[model samples]
Target: MIRFGVIGTNWITEQFIQAALESEEFALSAVYSRTEERAKDFAAKYDIPNLYTDLESMAASDQVDAVYIASPNSFHAKQTIVFLNHGKHVLCEKPIASNAAETKAMIAASQMNNVLLMEALKSTLMPNFRAVVDNLHKIGTVRRYFASYCQYSSRYDAFKQGNILNAFNPAYSNGSLMDLGIYCLYPLVTLFGKPNSVQAAGVLLSSGVDGEGSMVMSYKDMDAVIQHSKISNSYLPAEIQGENGTIVIDKINQPGSVRIHYKDGSVEDITVPQVKPSMHYEVKEFIELMKSGRVESTVNSHANSLAAMEVIDETRRQIGLVFAADLK
Candidate 1:
């Protein structure tokens, strides 16, 4: 079994741990937090044996063969590099790092150490996503792709009342684009490589982070329009238009229902049922790679992460969104 150590105690981390254990290919051997008390509290729920307050000590420990990082955006690069240098495989949460430069550095560290480093982008690994890929040809000669994911943040009310949180704060490299928009961009890059150029615009909050944004990526014969927001909610389904039909995705991030509507007024459902939680698929893939002694995921390859980051970098530039990590 692959012994796994987790670096964060948030809800997403909890979901990952649950998914990992449910896969039965991994064991939760260690838990790490900045404070011993927090680590202990989180570990208690899982009955974990190892509790670490220092990342270096956790990296040096023999209890874990791999580490799952779900820390804040700004901390992803440094924390991942530390684990990589120590020869531990890392499955980092999405948006990999603050920018493409940091992603390159993280990829270099993984290569230098010959350890697995994968972005935990659950969407691409989902069975339904694979179904969408398999049925893409039904819609011939793609012309336009439109995707939108917008959910009003629960913290937005507090922010409106004059309270600043990490989700809207620039110091931690948190924003709607990084947190939600990437969900749209990753699938775009995965389905159709990087675009030739991009045009973006967004509404920045008083704290200098995007609250909602839209971007149009121009390709040779098609254009993709992506809309993401944390200040409002959108019920529109994402669609890929072609000469023959359009593929409609229920949720761009966690696609549960996917269908095609043809010009002849016929509809086809192409979704594959998922028995396990959405996060379980990524964990299974990561363990399979580790067991096979592979250092990279063909699905969530380093190149894919870098390509997506380049788009994010360009979008941020167009939107005038700058993070403190970018200055560093």
Candidate 2:
């Protein structure tokens, strides 16, 4: 029952349309807003009968087949290649662009319109992030993977009373490592992958973006450290270290309870049962990969969104944090 269609009314698109109406596998239909009175007041506060201010007439509509796109990040690879060249199927919202050549041109327009393109990045389709990737073999010999997600930004007090908006705008590529350190680097590149070296530093916000940061990636014998901030607030609890224990991830953007902690001290809570506005498990894995026709996502893969956009373009090239779609 796909249907969908949405582009940004914020509050994370009203919590992804209230987790796509508690998922029967989605059906909302339409919503877009360049302002047809804020898209008919966000389609009459989410009854969503269809309202757009023309994004190519809701991507040349045939009444929507897919589109979640939470816009801004230089308009996610040209609005996901104009809704995958109008055939639809796109669930963007993440650092799926603004680098790595607009994520390889939105994964080559979802492989030249075969459709289905994910990356909603709800922490690796979190069932407590697949119970921390199935208890990571009981944390033995993993090495290290600390993550962090800072909060502090009720629009950073109107950007410290200067008012930059668009989340501290850098021409809408926004910051804090593309809005909260790509949720601690997409679950540390979905449980460790791309990192041989990264090293970073930040605290820019003179409208150059990145109001906070810290990175360090190097990996063969693992090293991860990836704190992030919108200007500070972390309750701590995002570890992975190993040699027989420590998984603990209370929330790297809704990991929602996970624990392991052993080395003989003994503790385990390999959380799995999660379903709520926890973005209904990435919209039920993007409608079960578009009803098994599939086009990407081996747990949000397009080679893990181009290796998390090449580790966010080498941590915004060693933390200078440039954007304007990284100079086109």
TM-score of each model, in listed order: 0.99, 0.34
Best by TM-score: 1
Per model, state how many residue pairs clash.
Answer: 0, 0
lDDT for 267 in candidate 2 is 94
Question: Against the hidden true structure, what lDDT does model 1 obtain?
Answer: 0.94
Off by over 4 Å in 2: 5-22, 28-58, 68-81, 84-90, 93-118, 121-123, 130-143, 146-185, 189-222, 225-239, 242-244, 248-259, 274-280, 284-307, 312-328
Relative to the unseen true structure, what is the C-alpha lDDT of residue 139 in candidate 2, on a scale of 0 to 100? 81
**lDDT (Cα, tens digit) per residue for candidate 2, span 1-328:** 8889899897888988887788886889899888789889888887888888889889998999999988887888898889898888899988778888888888888988899898898877867888788779878888888888898989889989998899889898887888888888887887787888888888887889888889988888979898889888988978888998988888888888888989899898878776477887888888988899888888788987788788888878786888886775
Q: What is the lDDT, from 0 to 100, of the residue 279 in candidate 1?
A: 96
Per-residue lDDT value at 74 in model 1? 95
Q: For residues 13-60, write the lDDT of model 1, one tens digit per residue.
A: 999987887876788999999988899999999999999999999999
Candidate 1, residue 22: Cα displacement in angstroms equals 1.4
* lDDT, candidate 1, at 52: 93
C-alpha local distance difference test of each model: 0.94, 0.85
The candidate scoring highest on lDDT is 1
